[model samples]
Target: MTTVPPFQRALEAHGDAVWRYLRGMVGAGAADDCFQETFLAALRAYPRLHRESNLRAWLLTIAHRKAIDHLRRRRRDALEPLGEEIEAKPQGDGAIWSAVATLPPRQRAAVLLRYGGDLAHREIAAAIGCSEEAARRSLHEGLKRLRETL
Candidate 1:
């Protein structure tokens, strides 16, 4: 069997999507911190990861945890997330993203995973620690809310 590279290689390969997912999760300002924590946590747990594990889903799962931690810390500070959200947009997608950013956290994560990270519902379910049906429902609700808002 061919051997795969380790966490460093995985980080280089999937960093952009993970960063974007974290940005969508907690906004740009906090994304870097969460991104770093995700890899750090992943580093600690890397040795235990199975060879067949989906690295993208695994990284996103770690990112999700880091995001939750960041949100909790932000809550302790009494700060709003989207209040200081992404200062940059992907050109012509600003309105759509604004609507997306207003979505409830679970819905937002669902949307981001489905579209931003290009993850299947099953992978998203794994990343978010939910049932596949729940991931689908969250995506549906998030899209409905986005349509309504936009």
Candidate 2:
């Protein structure tokens, strides 16, 4: 059997979180494709990884960028309309998935990372390629928008 590299191990370990993050970014249908692309990109760039510390954050960062690129490539002018079944379920604040779909990309990502993947501000910053303060601001702004919508 081939020995798994540390990076590979880390990728396997955190795959679910990365998938969840992508799902929130692109929705459930595209999540797996984005996840595969994220890991493939990671493998191509694996030689450059300098440290094991915060591997989850590192993987998430790659996943975030890949998700963004995937979205860009699709050239979607607006958020996809939510299906009726998904739209009917009430979110925590009695909002629906359609409301969540209306957020801007950055705020949506922050909200997804915070609530969907349960990442801290620091980790979210690493993933979103922003400062911790910025991550916090994004999350706060997202929540505020969600509150207003609901």
lDDT of 2 by residue, 1-150 (tens): 243366668776888788767766776667789888888888877777665456677778888898788778655654455333235545553243556667788888899888767788989988888899999999999889988987
| Root-mean-square deviation per candidate | 2.2, 4.1
lDDT of each: 0.83, 0.75
Query: Which digits, one per residue and each the tens of the lDDT, describe model 1 over residues 1-150?
Result: 544566789989899989888877787778888988889988888887878888888888888878878878888998765734653545466677667778888998999888878899999998888999999999999999999987
Q: Which ten-residue region of model 2 has the weakest summed lDDT?
A: 78-87
After superposition, candidate 2 runs with Cα above 4 Å error: 1-8, 76-97
- The most accurate candidate by TM-score is 1
Where model 1 places Cα greater than 4 Å from the true spot, the runs are: 1-4, 87-92
- Choose the strongest candidate by lDDT: 1
